[model samples]
Target chain A: MTVHRPQPPEDPDLPERPGPAGTPPRIPEPLSEPLSEPLSRADEAPWRRVHPVSPLIRGWIGLLAVAWFWGQNWFEDIILAVEDPGGRGAPPMEGIPFLGGVAWLLLVGGAVLVLVGLSFFLSWRFTKYQVTDQHVNVNSGVVFRRQRQARIDRVQAIDIVQPLLARIFGLAELKFEVADAGQTAMSLAFLRLGEAKRLRNLILARAAGLRSAPEGTGAPGPGLPGTGFSGTGAAAPGSGVGPSEPAAGAVPATDPAASPDSAASLDPAEAPERVVAAVPVGRLAGSLVCRPLTVATVVLVIGALVLQPVLTEDVSPLVVLPFLLGAAGALWKGFSSGFNFQAAASPDGLRMGYGLLDTRHQTVPPGRVQAVQIRRPLLWRPFGWYRVAVNVAGYGPGGDGGEERSTVLPVGTFADVLGVLSVVLPDPGTARPLELITAGIDGSGDAEGFRTTPRRARGLAPLAWRRQGFALTDTALFARTGVLGRALVIVPHERTQGIALEQGPLARRFGVCDVRLATTAGPVSPRVVQADVEVARVLFLEQADRAARARHRHDRDHWLEENPHG
Target chain B: MPQEPVDPQGIAWTRVSPKYAAVRMAGWAVGTAVTLLVLSVPLVLRLAGIWTWPPLWLAWAVPLAVLALDLVRLSLIPRQVRAIGYAERSEDLLVRRGLLFQRVLVVPYGRMQYVDVAAGPVARALGLCEVRLHTAAADATIEIPGLPAAEGARLRENLTARGQARLAGL
Candidate 1:
């Protein structure tokens, strides 16, 4: 006879303890230090040791993350529990003298969960992070040690992530995104929420090549203990590192690691970072619930529940349907990722992070953001809400989290959109970004120094000919196209990887070609569709010149600079 | 700008050696005849045994469609070959191909990852080759086919030199 079993989503293959952190994930190993490399970083140097509580935040996400790779066996039990309200029945202990098979299995399952949690805890305890002036090193693994070093100078972006449970405990994970495509972003998980913020600031400072002095050591000072940014923690006013602004009021203890000994340290008092744009909690909540995807999901869920008993099949739609339909994941992901969205500009680039469940802190320095796009869906017109996304070099391993990779604005007003876009493309290649954008998109085509597809090409791009076109300025290329829904992609010449012009039978017959400007960052495809062939040729040649010039003009050794804005 | 017809002839088109077209046509003719024979076998047998009305029509339809497609392919060979050409500029390689789409791609020498020339058995028999240019971006590869083997090699060498001189840094 078969025994009944309740399972938690567990992948059979996911190493509860990944044997080698750098393996399957396949993060590119750091290049070996040169033979003539300079002095090694001091072991006692401040910024060498990670905050004490690194394990809690990372392990929390790791446990939840396992549900994905795990066989999803736990899902069936959730459905079974809800499907059958049958009260707990006595186990078949009557047959087997002491205990029933079900009881034993339940005990085993509980024990496994406890064991998994303990392992995550142990893993967190063992993991160590060191941020030197030149590199950020992550070391972990109980039996087999793995150390990952990302050069601070080469850091593409830094993301601080907090999963739902970790957020409750005021913890987060810092991810280092680098320039190498084959290399995986190095993750430093589960630091105290306050400590994560301080660490992010310090790393950015070093990445900017600001090697004035080392900040502080790993241990927290006596005056500022328990500064994890938890609401429960009593944060001393004016605590730890920063320009004195409490990080969204989540300032944990001043980074005990920032500068305990040096009089010149821990105070970025001169480090000028001011909040450029922040979405209100109310607005963020409104955006989540009112999103087109969310509303459709709610409707579908309600329908599924209402149709549950009437369904012909024995399987419940509640649990099974979400697996069958992708929208459910989209709904949860859309709402959870951008909650409490905030964007700030420091001497570096723009720092944006948000998540009710998994908080992500990503910094795109001045020269790295390849492209910026501001889109207003037709449905959003009346509400005056626009969504914005940017593309930065080295935002790796997001597979298809296109929107997640560069979401500067989840939902914001027109003014808010301008505020964010201004940060992304401060020098939007135009003297007047406002007028240029308005004319290009509104189809109010009274030529504000922009052009539309030639009339002959109307046959090729029937619906969008009037609106689709590209404009070249000295610094950037702007392309706008849409029939019902519209998009405007701005790519600075310096950031363009390559540009392509495509034509097919139909396009040739219609005497037009499509020009695509490829950038190394973001998912936006900047294409000028159905342009006159001659026009495309000229644009192609012009773009090559513009790109070469743009590269030299903005040749920045460091991504971060002192002040950013038009 | 004045309107100009999207014509491949306007550019000083580099014609692929006619011998290549002949070899391609012969290969296509044999492939088409084999596919038609395979498809018509059941119809031929069924008609021979049962003398069925449907099989009679089906038999002719297979050959007819095959004939039509083969003839179209034969007629388009020159145009397809003629449509492909590459122009090496001072700083970039300009590749033009396609009869219908009139596609043109300008790959900067700086972005060139590598240049490759492939000659298949049929192409080698006809002394023809295809030059492929690759950039870091995957989809940005430009392949120009049906060039004389000598010309393909020359283009490859030229592009390689330009790429080395202009390769961009990370």
Candidate 2:
């Protein structure tokens, strides 16, 4: 067995490819036989163009603009001609010699069509993509040529998006999200759905540093030296697989033959995936009904109806039109994006599929999740529904078009939430994980060892004084806050970017402070608000040491060999 | 006066140069002069008999109020500068700032993405530079302003070295 250190590219012109001669065995073989056929042969014939109809599909927007302008002008010209039958008013194109109005229209329309077609052709000619074992590169742009290349290992998530237009043509788009926030590093748009899936699998497998194909017959061997029995194992008590003695019952062995779905005809090159949670349409609709925005919208509409008779006739319906449209639009966006949400656990990481018209399949790799927040809206408490979001390093800041791609579970039962949590973190760093999580969610006031906000905090947070607190385990910190809309944010000690203790003048008078744990730029922001100043200071100092120690313990970059499931 | 949160940490915090207060006062003076110059236009117009829409007292009142407020703020420069201090620990760097809303941030060296040494024209003339430590988190940008140029360079180098030594992936 040999260990391969990730070697930096030696030259600017030529990056060091992983699968060349004399390289380590683990990284090379999987590249050759990716998917059904030899993808290496396809890779050798590099710079493959996207689907031929890609330009036409993308050019529809431009086509629509042109058609709109032409239609508007054409209608005005015909109407003007009708109003003045004897050509008393000269047409706009009258300066041109000998051409009738219909002839001029045809000529100009043909010219516009030619220009649009030429530009589309040039765009199609210039745009090209290449996938090497080391990098995924895309070269595009007609005027200002741009070349984007993201390292295969740096890919944080891969999304397969099939918009209604593209889906009609049996095509999909591959979006590569790197560790940089809010930017798709590279996109190969309009590929055959099957090809896109295969390409995504190839990239994920290579990223995981797998020796065998992703869906090979054998289970992943104990490849890394210090994986299952590392000294840090004791710290991850929730994982249940103890370091000194592995618990067989807690972890289902990765035996494909033993699994019931082994008989299903799965793609040979894809990993055996198990669906962890699926939100039904009925539940999804119910969850949406309770949202604060939806409720407010409903109230506004009802109030408008109730006051209709008493209100003055001078009040126009258009006055309230904009607000109604805005609110309803927001609700529709939430509903569509979360239409058929499904979360699956695979060797690569957590795979989620959602969206109504434009279906999206996003795969967030293991170990990339910085923090997780399980939130229960006030109305959702009765149904026992919780929404889970995370702080992934790359997917932030309008990455989901103001619709949070960070949400791993949009709406799920408590059991479903735990299942997703178990897969994402694997180890909650506590012996009694269920009780601790339950306390963090439903219980308050020092339950399950949580340090609740002191009585002095009543002045600062009157309603949430009892619940605004924090709890710590060996591997992670749990900060719970809010009374009406409860939130429990869990930040793994290793992932904590910084710890801060903040105190305002009012809080200073009350001898209270807030402790904040900064993670990546996403939805989950861990903060213990309105705590005793003395306790906050101690926790702040202690948290720094804990984070440093946690970082020291968990250093493995190649997560595939760890066998998180087993 | 409120207690400083850094008291319990027992870490020796390095204070910025005293000249920073002078720099800040000078900046405030320039800003106030420009503001007063722009604001006195209405007063000049009212007094010159060219325009009397705004009452003469009202025009005069605005600039006087701005000057008075600026004077009070300018006096607190030294104390605000004193409140801003940074401490370098074995595993992390701690930055504390703000007089009324005191905040102390402890950023682990391993979490640092990069170190930036920036000097504005005013600070550059005064031979001072600011050091900024950027992490993956957007909110974790730790800025330690008003250091001597040489000290700032040294801190940047030290932080960059430490970050590389204990570098962890996002």
Candidate 3:
């Protein structure tokens, strides 16, 4: 292995060698290296496979599901045979008289287990991936082979994932969040945890346009096609239990979607590649408990439980079942999705990673954030804690309501919220971003140039009447509304998709209107509802002006010096 | 003498075609008649001895109920048409509409992905076309109705031109 210092692009005078005609072209890694040499088709690049144990780890869920089905079938027959000696329906073992029910059950369960295990092993052998300077490529499938390549420049975020099973073996998966609106994110699962971390850093460094130099250390970690086959599955010892190595020629395989167990042994948690900020576990738990939705769910459950005794015997379980499940689901979702929230500033923009059993890594570029919402629930106001969520392009609505993945700050102080927002929006081009943000958050209508809803709108929006207002700066539009859970969304004009004004019969009669700034489908909704009609109209026009000037700067020569005349 | 309270926002307003009010009202009338006819046919046929299982007068209930709603919509169409307005700012397009719960939407020309001009049978007969503009946001589709066909085309061309210019600058 050689230590290669990153270099700038080479001079064009050098000779360039082209690869073989028929094979895939060898794309060079970032501009740090000289482009004088052409990559050889045969050895320069090749598809790589994951760890041999990957298939079992990836396919473990399917295997267990099959085993569970078989186990349930036998358990019923065994129970009947043991309890009801002379039942009307004969037990399953009756047909196999030589072996009693117990023996038959073991035989079938073992056979099914072995068959499923073998299939997972074979499936793992087929899946493979490769990373070039320009793109990260994955070639996968057993029956229907498929190849996917995401350009390095378009990579939005990369998540390092460790499912319980993979975690047990000290393995991690690299999940790529791309900026292609129509495509689903890509995942390279089940690599050595150390290797996964390094790959994440290497890929990010390249994607940030700081392309690393030509081949140094030469090893494509442990998972490239040829290297993975030769590297001993020593990491497998951590989870594979038995030390019996597979025969040299046996094809190794991998799987995904494993159900993780509770914390068995917490490794003195490895430092996040670059920790910017991490939400304390205690704070996360406290915030989840105090959240309005969490409290409402818990109260509903308790109320239902209290009524359980009065309901008839048949209705008792029905009443208890759904309420208990609903309460548990909400609490678990709140805790798991937000657990261990960590935010770090990277060259690629602000990077966030959260989740308990199924950890996710999301990288949001600066320009990709369409809007930002800072919200403070009524209960959270006492403690000055807020939640931050953003609308990001190409991320899409995959969660329950696009809330789960879009959450950048599940819980934070006023300062933490602004810190995260700064990373996303960077420069609102205002002299006092902090003042604008704070005024937008808890400030009254009189603060700055924020104009509130009219007194006539009082009856229309009785709860949020005076609170509804909008303040615009050169680069951002701030819309403040909501009585109980006050929300202020700051949208940069360049990112604004469209602005709309709405009026209902009552609002029209009140002589007020609503103006909403629409962004892509995500958590943050930037809208000023029930503003004085005149105020809304002015806002509409002013926003257009600000957005246009801001857009001219953003879409035009952003790098060039600012124009003095305009 | 005190003047009426001033409109604070002060955006210049451009009203929709005056003929559009009658066209919209007529449209509501046609829609109501179609709905009533569909509902009344079953009962009318049963009463005339074409069918018997379901009673005839029950069908009349729907049209009668529809009459009240249709009457309100038809009467409100004029106010709604008069209320609709738009203003073309230097960088974005502003559209305002609705009588009671009024709405004003500002769509920057650069953000507009495309512009569509659509006129159904009724609108076409009135020589008016609805210009619908789309932005990247799923909910940010704005429609400007009751524009003369020529005006709609001209707006579309101007919008496309602006969209290109802004995008190039970005």
Candidate 4:
């Protein structure tokens, strides 16, 4: 592949240059030429080596595993029939007297071996990946060829995974998650380490270039200047290239009077430059290593180890050794896999790269982000940081035939969380500026600037244990009460669907009621917030009115557009 | 300060038929009876096996007790019906119902996506129907039970038309 060196313009303000003055400007090279020519078929287009895992074979193996465990009783019954041919201490076998004993063992053993062998062979053959200038492509499958391609622009995030065995073999798997088109998000997996990193950088550069470019192109321009838009050849040093300048419908003007700093920041090369300096390896590892799933897995393993001997009478205690060993190996693998997690602010959005055996890389673009959530668990309080996740449309499965969506950052520190949030949210700084509204135990008086609703105030001192309520920095949304646990939710005015006012027999006697403001994100089920029935009625009406007004201003269609990077 | 009771009109009532109260009461009765009958089956068989006279009477008495409980519950249907009501205006739809406690839910017609009107055999015989107002909220669904059939249909039509108009304006 040919590499292009960008030419620097002659400017007195620029620092001394190391390269020769008269050399021709080099155009950055594309990763690989598209297979536009008919002659370049699969064979000629650089034979991609892949490890195959056929879908049919994978299904069969999964079936075999299930049958082995679930049909253990059937297997045991067959053994009993052979041991006691005359049906002594055995349930009567009603059919198929001939070849019953030998057939059973052959069927079970044959099925198990076939499934395991096929799986291993397929895993070895079909998994091959190629990273190109525009997209990352993965080809896998033995019987049914499955090929998945994710454009650099649409790739939201990349994850690297290195299984213990794969790490031993010096191999890593790269997972490229693209924004979902419908219920499925495109993914590319399994690439060599060096190739994966190089490809990751190429995709990151393209994503960043797309972000910095005028929004209409959607396609990422080459890293070199003058390649972004047609007829706008390389501008001289210091040409004003404000985004609005392109909107004025003026022909490209070559002027050498714009600020260099602004122009430099827009450059595609500058995309990697900014990210390279701030890649938070430690923060990324901290985010991925201590996820809830990891904790749950560890707890399950410990429980299984403790119960193994007690649960099985016939099996000797030695059988538990393999189970313990496997659990320990898996735990160690999980830890090592996330140890190298790294997240960087790339031009397109944010790029999270990590893995132990198979490296997974992800790139998220800003346009694909639907919403941002910042959560602070009690255990994470001492860290003075919050975990951040983005709600993106068509990104994950919604459990009952609904669209699939997923969070961008499953975990991250406050600064890292804020950094990613700024790119995805319209106003990144809004969370920091807002004061948190907390629900009190009673309807009594509150801290300065906070007040309890009238319903809660009625039994203030006496029934304080049951009532809790508060509004935020602004009274736009309120968390009134939670009987079991406190929950704070932001009910956007536009997103509010309705209001519910509930009064129990006891509450009615006390002239107190609870009101809930519902939103599209989820139902706001606040309990025990006290207010008079009349006040509750009025609050419901007011909230509904605000919701209607807000809904009017929302543009649902904007979220439907396909994001090039997730 | 003590607050005066808010007018019932101010509270939102579900757009449902009075027959829903009857159906709910019937369902509760059936559920209770079935539960008691299931619990008595083994006892009856065991009683028949040993000490037949007094045990058989006790076994027979269990189902009778369940039937009596169901009858008492059925008697509360009218009061339950009185507690349920539906109110619809140009801007919003309200559904209110409760036994011992009252709940008033308000769903703005503009935010409503659709309204579903349905009736089971018993409700149809009683000339009543149930209406459910669907919104974008993931979990919040406003259901009004036991409305006269004609009123339920009219409310559904109005809600649908208003929702369409609001959505079009957007």
Estimate, for each residue in B1-170, the C-alpha lDDT of model 1 and write its tens digit: 11224422233444556566776677787898788888777677777786555657777787788779888988997766666666666776666665655556666777776788998888888788888887645556878777788888888888888778766543
Give the residue spans of candidate 4 off by over 4 A.
A1-376, A385-468, A472-487, A506-512, A519-535, A559-566, B1-15, B50-72, B110-115, B147-150, B168-170
Candidate 2, residue B133: Cα displacement in angstroms equals: 1.0
Every model's DockQ: 0.36, 0.68, 0.45, 0.34
TM-score of 3: 0.70
Q: The CA-based lDDT of model 3 is what?
A: 0.64
TM-score between model 1 and native: 0.69
* lDDT (C-alpha) at residue A271 in model 3: 19
lDDT of 3 by residue, A292-362 (tens): 67777767778777887897777654655676687778888888878777665443466777767766666
Give model 2's DockQ, 2 decimals.
0.68
Off by more than 4 A, model 1 = A1-130, A137-149, A179-183, A213-271, A281-329, A396-401, A459-464, A560-566, B1-78, B112-136, B144-170
Q: Per-residue lDDT for A1-566 in model 1, tens only?
A: 01112322323433233222212322111112211112224343332333333443345456556544332434444344345434232222323322243455457656666677567546754565666557776767878877776777776777776666556555566677766542446876656555566667666666665554233321121111111112212112222211233543232354334333332232222234445556665666666666677677777778888898898887568574654367656666776676556666554566675666556666776666777777777666666667787766577324534468677888777656665655566576566667776665565342666667888778766787888887777678878888666778888886676677777777777667788886653566678777787777777777876776565455564544423221
Tens digits of per-residue lDDT for model 3, B1-170: 11112222656777779778867877777888888888888878887888887755566676787888888888788778887887787777877776555566778887787789998888899899999987767788778899998998998898888888875321
Give the per-residue lDDT of model 4 (tens digit) for A1-566: 21222322223422211111123322121123321122212223232432222222224456556556636756676677677666453444445452574476568756765665556556544555544545556666677877766665555545444444334433344555543422344333333343344344445545444333332223222121111222122111112210111222121222134344322222223233122112244544454345554566556667766887688777555654665576557555544444344444444454444444443444555444433444555444454444444443333435311211243343444344434443443231123322232222112245423335564445543544333554433214544443332233334444456777777677767676777665434112333266666666666777666666655555232221333223
lDDT of 3 at A12: 57
The recovered share of true contacts, given per candidate in order, is 0.37, 0.69, 0.77, 0.57
Give the worst 10-residue stretch by lDDT in candidate 2 chain A.
A240-249
Give Cα-based local distance difference scores for all models.
0.60, 0.74, 0.64, 0.47
* lDDT per residue as tens, model 2, A1-566: 01122322223422112121122312111112122322343235245556656666666676667777887887766666666655445557554433367578878887777676677657765777766666777878899988877887777888888887777766788888887877778888877676677567767766776533434423422222212222221121112111111121111222234333321111225555556667777788999898887888778878888888888999754566788899878778888888777776666778788777777888887788989999999999999999999887768756554344888889988767876787677678777788888899888888788998889658778888888899998788999998889999999888899998888988888888888899877777789888787788888888998888788777545567444323
